[model samples]
Target chain A: MKTLSYFLILAFSGGEHAGGGSPLDVNPGLILWTVVTFIFLLLILKKLAWKPILKSLNDRENLIKESLEKAEVARKEAEKLIAENKLNMQKSEEEAQKIIEQSRELAEKLKMQILEDSKKTANKMLEDAKAEIERKNAEAFNKLKEQVADIAITAAEKILKENLDKAKQINIVDKYLNEINKN
Target chain B: MYTGQELIGADTLKQVAETAKKTDTSWIMHDVLDANEIDLTPFGIIHLPHLNLFGFDISITKHVVFMWIAMLILIFVLKKVAKSYKSSLIPKGVTNLTETLILFVRDEIAKPTIGKGYENFLPYLLTVFFFILTCNFLGLIPYGSTATGNISVTATLATLSFLVIQIGGIWKNGFFGYFKGLLPHGIPAWLIPIMFVVELLGLFTKPFALAIRLFANMTAGHIVILALIGLIFILHTYVVVPISIAFALFIFLLEILVALIQAYIFTMLSSLFIGMAVHQEH
Candidate 1:
């Protein structure tokens, strides 16, 4: 066997072409060993290496799915918040508008009330001034009528004194008055 | 399109030599070995360029080394991740990342399709996604082999998905009920046999489609990037630095997207199949 191995080694080691060796010609034993080792390793990997590894991967996938679901819920909540904010804003705007209208109505009512009171007060003052002026004019007219009557009586007395004596003059005046009445 | 060394150019030889020297092979057959000078037209591995092995010819090459390395990485990464889950709720760091993906597959992919009480199928779905993604991403690495790029690998994965769908379906419904679920409710009696044949054929066809879809998608991206890289080589023939830089950046971005997309598509299709199997009506 040693001689055969030496011969085999000698044949292979000869100085020959550089690029001409077939794979089948070298290391048949090594090839067999390699195949067997590969199969064995495959079995061991399946048992010891792959099982635990798969579990971890499954865990990670589950984690990702859970996180995605949480993100979706958060997004929905944010949308609801935005919607609520818009609703509140609209409600406040409507309330503010209503308050402004009510204030304007109150202001208009106050202005109308002030105008009505001033007109009533002016009417009362005008009536009082007219009554005072009318009373003053009536008093002046009475005084002028009294002065005219005094002047007419004085003229009549002067005419009678020149015509007759005092007692006879009275009788003559009465007869003249009676004659004037008959005529 | 070319699987091995037939597509190798002169510069690819130099790269292979540099890589081989870096691997620290203390045993040397010859004192002076300029790999660039060696003629490689005779070997079938030439279809895959820029690939070489330590001390072999016309067989497995650096791409195979990358494949092996990817397998080792898958084992080591899975082991470390599994070990981290000893005490706590779940593992942290790389374990945590893997664990999240597993859960995504269980909850998003398997649960929706497989219906209630689908947690039991998480193991199988997680296994399929990680295993396929690992293999698919392996090809995105520089000088890395995409095991899923091979039709065989995709076919195997698709077959497993098919098996699971059937098994799960059978488990959910009884043996007879499972088959009966295939036919729609309104089919006339005369068309039942024909529909059964078509449905049976479709059952196989679904996995076949899965295999082709994954294999084509994974392989197409790599080939496009390889071709783009090849453009620089063809253009300058010698100035590979700038071209490599540009192509690497473009391919890196594209590969990252491709890696995620491939993982998603595999998981989606698998889930769809499982869903169809379990709940045939909806």
Candidate 2:
């Protein structure tokens, strides 16, 4: 390797003095130096600069991509939650409507039941009042008939006492009683 | 186009050197384009120290130093941004800017061109984009030279891309399959050799254009700016300074845009070539 580089240097520097007339001359030495310098620069830079920079750039790109994917998932989840909420709200509203209808039916039935109960109670009260009035009228008519019977008996007894003697009265009364009986 | 005095000065020095060589004059100096003299080297506006290592002239030129500065700047800024990246998921400030650029290269350039295999080449594309951009921007600085403007440097980068393209092909399709895949299925056997040559040339021409396009574009911008500044020097008058400075500033701002554009073009073309090599459907 050393000998090869030495030969390369000699060969490159050999034509240095050939073109002295113009400044457009070629210098093999400068060529050798430039080649060495450029190669050295390339190697060092590849190791130190390009490797890490490219890696970081790629890393940042991947990070952004992953974040975007995560955001999409989150947005989808939010949409699903919103849809579920809407569905739940609809179900609750339906339940509330059903409850209102049931209560209205129940109220109508309750009003009818109350009206029937009041009519039955009013009929029973009217029948009880008519029975009491009929019983009081029958009791008054019996009492008046008993009093007229007593007065008629008293008047007949007084008339018999005033008109005739004892025996004759008895015979006359018998005759009269017989005549009264025949009449 | 009025040439600059620096070129005229070099020409005179060259003439002086040739004359001295022929006549052995006593008063002739040792170095004509010496450090003390004005530098007219095509590679750099200011001459720098020449370094030699292991029988090779590894000179510390202005472009090399500026390339190092650009590299250091890239390392420091990227490291800081990388540290910030570790702590936070979101980017801010310089981290935000750098991340935007990196992501643009990945999504717009690497991903669209390379497709499924973009990850494998992202680091390399990023490196080329940043390195070339830094080098291009360095040129717009007052005294900083553009290393990408140099042919050797641009050639080296292009060669790297070419190597990646071929290697990616070979790795995707085995050695034999890769060579076989180059020729179309319906071609006559007599035309196979000609087709092979054409395809191979096509392979080379792509990277060649890459290197030349970057080098020429970067070099041309600087030359225009220098030429604009040279106008002031050629006229040798203070009256021309405002106009020259204004034009130079306008081109300098334009250079900033061109610098970014050329870097993007280089990386985009590289990714396209690699994509074609690895997937070779048509």
Candidate 3:
């Protein structure tokens, strides 16, 4: 192997220096030596070097793959949580809209009920006022008629210039009261 | 003594220019290293024509010294990183960072392809990946040699992967079973011989593919940076320093990215090969 390496070095250097010959003008001895050396190196390395290096690389690869899988699963879980939150928000919004509509309807119903009640109350008050006025007028008229009859009786008694008998006066007054009462 | 100038001469430079004009294999190097020569003393220190230290010199070439330092850094850094391993504790610092890479190769690369007994192959795959990656990256430094830029280096690395596939397959499946396994299951009796030949050829082709891919990618990036820097010299020798530096730096940064990509591709392909061999279904 060493000889092969040396021959290759010489041949390559030669080719580099002067270049009229074919590229394949290789020395067989060097080729053989190279082959032998390569095999030797391979054996030594296999025994002493490769195991540790390969092990480290494999460990790194596995570590990377595992981390990637974990990240993927976590991302999926986060997405699911976000979706659930969005659905809940949509449901709440709909519920809030329903509640607002119900309250509006209630307010409208209450307003209409108050309007109807006030109209009924106002009609009742107007009817009571008319009945009260009629009662007062009738009382006043009856009292005036009684005062005029008393006054007319006193004046007739004075014009006759005679003392009227108590029984006949009583009888005339009763008869007049009865006639007024009847009328 | 081996400075960049010592290795290059007017005649050699002329030859280099001529080669560049004619062939597809020309390489470009910008004036990043203000040295006379690219030295190999550091790599040549321990292993030479003979592995012996005759005498030590204080004034060694900087590039050579730097190469030694780079290799030591590669070794020490890797060792230090590996030393941090324990059964229960979490890996820390450089160890932790590398541990991650190790695990990747074991689980994603070695284990998946090699199947039930993948643990056995983890060490090999991890080493190959790191070794090649380190070598490729080191070359990106200014005045550095791309070890993988050389076909021999790549071929050797490829060969090792090839050997693992072959030997491991043979061990698991048995010698006779290994050969028989190569043949397609549904081929007619007459066509079995032809199919067997094709299958045998296919086995060899996989490693060759590995070799070419790594070598080309590593070499290509350097060439691009070199070419970009060389543009100022080729187009106009004087008064183009700023423009050359800007383009060169831009490509140099791009080369860093390319360096990493090439390393990754090499490792991935090796793992795929192991997987193919271990799992006979395909």
**Global lDDT scores for all candidate models:** 0.64, 0.79, 0.64
Give the poorly placed runs of model 1, Cα more than 4 Å off: A1-41, A52-183, B1-71, B83-92, B236-248
Residue B258's lDDT in candidate 2: 97
Model 1 residue B231 distance off true place after TM-score fit, in angstroms? 2.1
Q: Pick the candidate with the highest lDDT.
A: 2
lDDT of 1 by residue, A1-183 (tens): 443454454345433433233212333333333344346655766666566556555666787899899999999999999999999999999999988898888889888888888887788778878887787777767765665555445435744555767777677666656654573
Residues A1-183, candidate 3: write the lDDT tens digits: 443454465556655455433334343434443444455555544444444535544665687889999999999999999999999999999999999999889989888888888877888878787777777777777777676666567646643444588877677767666766775
DockQ of 2: 0.21
Window of ten residues with lowest summed lDDT in model 2 chain A: A14-23
- My TM-score estimates for the predictions, one after another, are 0.51, 0.72, 0.54
Highest DockQ against the true fold, candidate: 2
Q: Which is better, 1 or 2, measured by DockQ?
A: 2
B139-256 per-residue lDDT for model 3 (tens digits): 8764466666666557767777788888878887788888888887887899999999999999899999988988788777677667666667566566777877887788778778
